[model samples]
Every structure is written in C-alpha cells, then in structure tokens.
Target: MRRVIMLRALVWSVLLFVVSFGCAQERDPIVRIQANALSKAFFVGDLKDPTDDPEFYLRATVVDVASGAGSDGLFTNSDAQPTVRVRFEITEDMLLARLTYERID
Candidate 1:
C-alpha cells in the first residue's frame, strides 16, 4: 500500500512539472501578414489547450497589427504534424486557413 501511494505521488509530481513548464512557453510570432506578407506584433494572446483533441492540438491566437484581426493557429507536438520548433513563426497571412485537424475520438 505504501509503495503504491509513493508511485502515484511520483507520477503526479512529474505531470505537474511538465504542465507548469512545457505548456506555458511564450513564443508568439508575428501578428500581421498583408499583401502576401506578415503582420507586426503588438502583443500575443494566451495559449489555449486542446478540448476534444487534448492529445493533439495546442491553439493560440495572434492579433493582426493592421486590421486588429485575430488569426488563430494550431501548434501540434505530434510527429505527424510539422514540428513546432521549425514552424512556430507565423510569417504568412493565413487568415482563412482551413481546419485540417479533427477530433480523433
């Protein structure tokens, strides 16, 4: 009983650490991309975690400087999707990007 309790505690601790650190990274890129270009960033909005697809997507919004419009983008940690490290920068105006990822469950 004591060993089981200790194992559970360890798992919870590791999960907490990852949640606090990894999910809260601030890497907001450009905000506007006009005329086949990108937007300048005034500020970045908060990161939103996946709801139905919790294991798949990390959603965030960038505010466009020119039009004050928000462009929502998805960041995935999955290997199937483009790695977030190289693809984090939103340099193009993808205002009408279609939802490519759907709920698996």
Candidate 2:
C-alpha cells in the first residue's frame, strides 16, 4: 500500500510540474517587430496609421532603444502617457516615446 501511494504521488508531482511549466511558457509573448515600423517609430516618430487621440501609431513592446546609447520608455502629457513626439528631437533633453501596441503571436 505504501509503495503504491508513493508511486502515485510521484506521478502526480511530475504531471503537476509539467503542467505548470507549460503554462508559464505560454504566458510570455513570442513576437517579432516589423523593422520598417520599428525604425519609423523609433527614429522618425512616424506611424503609418496616425491613430486617434494619444495617437498610438507604433506597434511595439515597451523596450529599450539605443541611439549610440540606451534608452527606456518615458511618459508625457497630463494623461501621463508613455512616449510622445517632442519637437523633432530639437532639445538635448527631449525624446519621443510613442505608445506601443503589442502584437501577440
């Protein structure tokens, strides 16, 4: 009886482990950004579709961009939105952070 229960418990543990692992893997997104879209948004602040208010023209993940350096997404406006075009990169301290629309695959 002891052996049977122990064996059953081991099997159940393995099953549970596998199930949990599979779930974790699926929870993360696996996606590729369009290069044209990425460059346009990151460099030119041009989103092909000039969306509605807040203007979510870019489809991307909130991520780091390096311009001979590294950068993180930042917010702007009274609404506190992440990424806004700020004067054509005119100011030394200003940066454009466009809202990212993530595409899940």
Candidate 3:
C-alpha cells in the first residue's frame, strides 16, 4: 500500500512540473520579415511573457543618406553592415518595445 501511494505521488509531481513549465513559456518572434524591410525603427510596446502577440505599426526614423532624397535604398544589398537589430517581447494588447540599434559605416 505504501509503495503504491509513493508511485502515484511521483507521477503526479512529474505531470505538474511539465504543465507549469509549458505555461511559463513565452511567445513567438514578434517582428516579421516584411516589417524589417522598412528603413526605420519599429517600436513594439509593452511586451510581457512569451504567450502574447500584439498588433502595431512602424514609424520611420532615419532614412538612407546616400541613396537619394526620400529614397530608402540607402541600405546595402548584401547582408553585411548597415542593419538594424530589434529586441522585443510579446504581450496581450501592445508589444513590448525593447531597443533598436543601427549598424552602419
């Protein structure tokens, strides 16, 4: 009888652990490739845990300098320098805006 009780408790403990771990996980990648094509900073506001997806817009900050006036072709064709890295989180209502940095020569 004691052995049976111990085995049942162990099984319950393992199941509980797995369920809690999955619930604590976060969401998917917030930014899409189409959004990254824009030559400005994209701000996603108020990202919480990993189980949320927010809908937001983008605002252009700095355009390409040498391409042309009002021309966003200033970035290079190669996947080398002059790129932006966006750090963000997913939330229920708004996206969590982390930080965006431009790497250009």
The best candidate by lDDT is 3
lDDT of 2 by residue, 1-105 (tens): 999999999999999999998888445686676655433344445444343223333333445544665333342232354343322221355645543455355
**5-102: candidate 3 lDDT, tens digit per residue:** 99999999999999999899687878755843633223333233333433344344544354545534543343233334445554456545543545
User: lDDT of each model, Cα atoms only?
Assistant: 0.44, 0.50, 0.53
Ranking of all candidate structures by their lDDT, best first: 3, 2, 1
Residue range with the least summed lDDT across 10 consecutive positions in model 2: 82-91
Model 1, residue 81: C-alpha shift (Å): 65
Candidate 3 overall Cα lDDT vs. reference? 0.53
For model 3, what is the alpha-carbon lDDT of residue 47?
A: 34
What is the lDDT, from 0 to 100, of the residue 27 in candidate 1? 80
Ranking by TM-score: 2, 3, 1
User: Considering summed lDDT, which 10 consecutive residues are worst modelled in model 1?
Assistant: 38-47
Question: Candidate 3 at residue 14, lDDT?
Answer: 100
- Model 2 residue runs over 4 Å out of place are 26-87, 90-93, 96-105
Give per-residue CA lDDT, model 1, range 1-105, as digits (tens): 999999999999999998999788788997664675522221112223223221223344333344654433322223235422111222355422224345355
Report the Cα lDDT for residue 82, model 1: 40
* TM-score, one value per model: 0.25, 0.30, 0.26
